[model samples]
Target: MSFDGRLLSGISVLAAVVQSRNFARAADVLGITASGVSRAIGRLEERVGVRLLDRTTRSMVLTDEGRLFYEQVAPLLFGIEEAAVSASGAGGVARGRLRVDIDPYFLRSQLSGRLGGFLRAHPELTLELVTRDHVGDLVTDGIDVAVRFGEPVVASAIARKLMETRVLTVASPGYLKKHGRPVHPSDIAGHHCIQFFDPVTRRPFDWEFHRGRKVLPVATLSRLYVSDVGTMVNECLAGTGIAQVLAIRIQPLLESGRLIDLFPDWSGETFPLYALYPSRNHQPAKVRAFVDFVSKVIREPPAHR
Candidate 1:
């Protein structure tokens, strides 16, 4: 069959089924009945002269042909969606779904309070927040924006610097009293240190510190290793060991005297936080509004020390 004669609707239906992995679930997502969905897939297979799906009483599975078809058409569907969003008249109101990927710690500590205000400003917009430490493909994952710490290596998206993150090495006051605070970077090797395991690297992250005009690295004698920053903070609060975390995330603990900054003379490197999106041109209203709000929040001067 000619491409012009092919039904894009059938392609979309097939894609939804493959993505959702169930005919009923796909139907619910596409606002159609399960039988209707099955008919659409049947018609699609007939037109293409290929069996696209393997169906059983319990579940639906995509055949090899279906997988290949989905891979080829998903990108085209995404492009069409983007084009439609771009052509939409935004007016002064933000509408439609705004999908965002962000780190859990940053979202909870920084963005949580501000999100209420943002939602109030754009009542028509629906927010879908995905909290994860690892970065994901915005296009393939159908994410509208991503808030990430440090630098992003992905060249496909447009990355805008949101803010600079200040990191600090800290421990609970009790832990410090028991283990004795390290006066210098080299002294850390003598103490029981908390190690942060990078999820992406699957290895322990090196401890970073500053000494006068030079940078110092400390190899830790890890008593505890954790992947989540929240858990690391909790461990430090419970007097487990010293941890390196974003200063903002631990500011309240520091102020409350529950956590003490170790080696006051040394500070870790400042990492850039960025907001990445699929493209700058023809951005959707919801995405544009979110980026603007987030940027404004980041631009606000840090509180006086």
Candidate 2:
């Protein structure tokens, strides 16, 4: 095959594979079968006269040659996209797909209702909100942006601090009424405490508390353990046990008198919530617009009561 033809096919197949991460997913994205994707990749490798990917039944990883090829071509492809956008005057408008990954609990409490205004602001933009507890890779996964808790560990990504999340110990009013509110951190050892299990660490999180210039760790007496923060909040609301959760997650329940804050004077460590992307240099206009909108929302007061 000619160089042009080989390059064209390679770029397409490479992009599909990188975006999807699996032959089946790539096939779905490209409107083809898994066998078709495999065939295309095979042809691409034959044309280039080099193996591009290391594949197994479970996973597909790129070879050194494939990585170099992708690094060189990705920018060119993005440049072409940017040129098209400029020629079409799309840069002046917010349009096209805006893909974002966010924590499920944060999205439910903070972004669910407020997204309407963002959509209204950019009428032409199509938004895809992916709610997952697992951290997503922005580049290979084709995510335009992500709203996540904590600082970005990846050096390649650009992170902007959106807000500081405050953790609180709370329980349903009925639970407190029945079991009595704990006056000290040691008091929690006797109470039924709802624990969030860290999936990566395989350990239940202990409750954190501050005592005037000293931080104290309250070892959780977990009667019920859960992975989902939303479920934990609901369990607390059902009068199951005291839960240590992000303050924003339980704000509605607190305001509605369904839940009461325990150890009101004690505050846990505050962590930064960040908006992250694959760096600012030559960022997509759609991504820039979405990030700016999200930053604005973060700066503003909570829309919910």
Candidate 3:
């Protein structure tokens, strides 16, 4: 007949864990100790008559029943948060937790050095930036927006094309001096090239160069294959091998003379950057603020991207 306030507290703790993905992070968000967070979850599990989280020393995940419970509870939590924001007259402000899924290369090359301004502008928002290779379930992962290159994987979400950056095949001067620059794309066969995998295809992306309307698909050789673009860039810079990278990502290096664009004339190939969000309607202010900040940060002079 009466409301159990403790149940609400437990639900809040559960939501925190789902958003933060660990007891320590959840504890920080809730302003409680890690042990306190664990106790809260224990009490919550006892009350619910099933284990909501399967926890190991290194990681934790929602059980099947836990995920179902979370699915039912998540909408209620969102409603409560919206109502609270409205009641406090901060509904339109970017004042809540903002979880962003970003590409590792974009984070390192573009957003890392520029985020201080955004953080200063939105002091009330807690920004969690997660670097991922693929766009997973946004709601289940608690991701507010995904900033990535290439196309959107899911049809349900909204996708905004931010910019298209040219792809350049580059090598350090040291590597080129030793192996000689490839005048033609086919000459790339003899040189060691850093391979970046296509997360969707589960194989290293086949190297391709474009000049005008001509497309040259090179069967490149690689002694090193990196899973992320940042690492591939580093490997290229280290004289390990030639790498095909987004031009905007390495424009500074090219200008600094640390890495040379093997064929600047072959810069016709381009990759598009996109911001994908869970919904088109009632999008959170935090998501909009972040997406806009990213747009401004990564866009280059028309020549660069």
Best by lDDT: 3
Q: Tell me the tens digit of each residue's lDDT in model 1 across 174-242.
A: 898888888877888887778888788889887888756789887888868888888888988998888
Residue pairs in candidate 1 whose N, alpha carbon or C atoms collide under 3 angstroms: none
**Clash count of each predicted structure:** 0, 0, 0
Which candidate leads in TM-score?
2
Candidate 1: residue 193 Cα off by (Å): 1.1
Q: What would the per-residue lDDT of candidate 3 be over residues 1-305, giving only the tens digit for each residue? A: 99889998999999888888888889999999999999999999999999999988777888888877886776676777777888998887887778898888778877776688899999998888988778887755878889889878877568899999899989999998888899888899998988898887788887888899999888977788768777888888889999988887888899889999888887899999998876435566788889888887765463433
Clashing pairs in 3: none
Best-to-worst TM-score order: 2, 1, 3
lDDT (Cα, tens digit) per residue for candidate 2, span 5-58: 666866887777876788988888889888888888998888778888899877
TM-score: the better of candidates 1 and 3: 1
Give the C-alpha miss distance for residue 256 in model 3, angstroms: 2.1
Summing lDDT over every window of 10 consecutive residues in candidate 3, give the lowest-scoring window. Answer: 296-305
lDDT of 1 at 290: 91
For model 2 the local lDDT of residue 179 reads: 95
Cα RMSD of predicted structure 1: 4.4
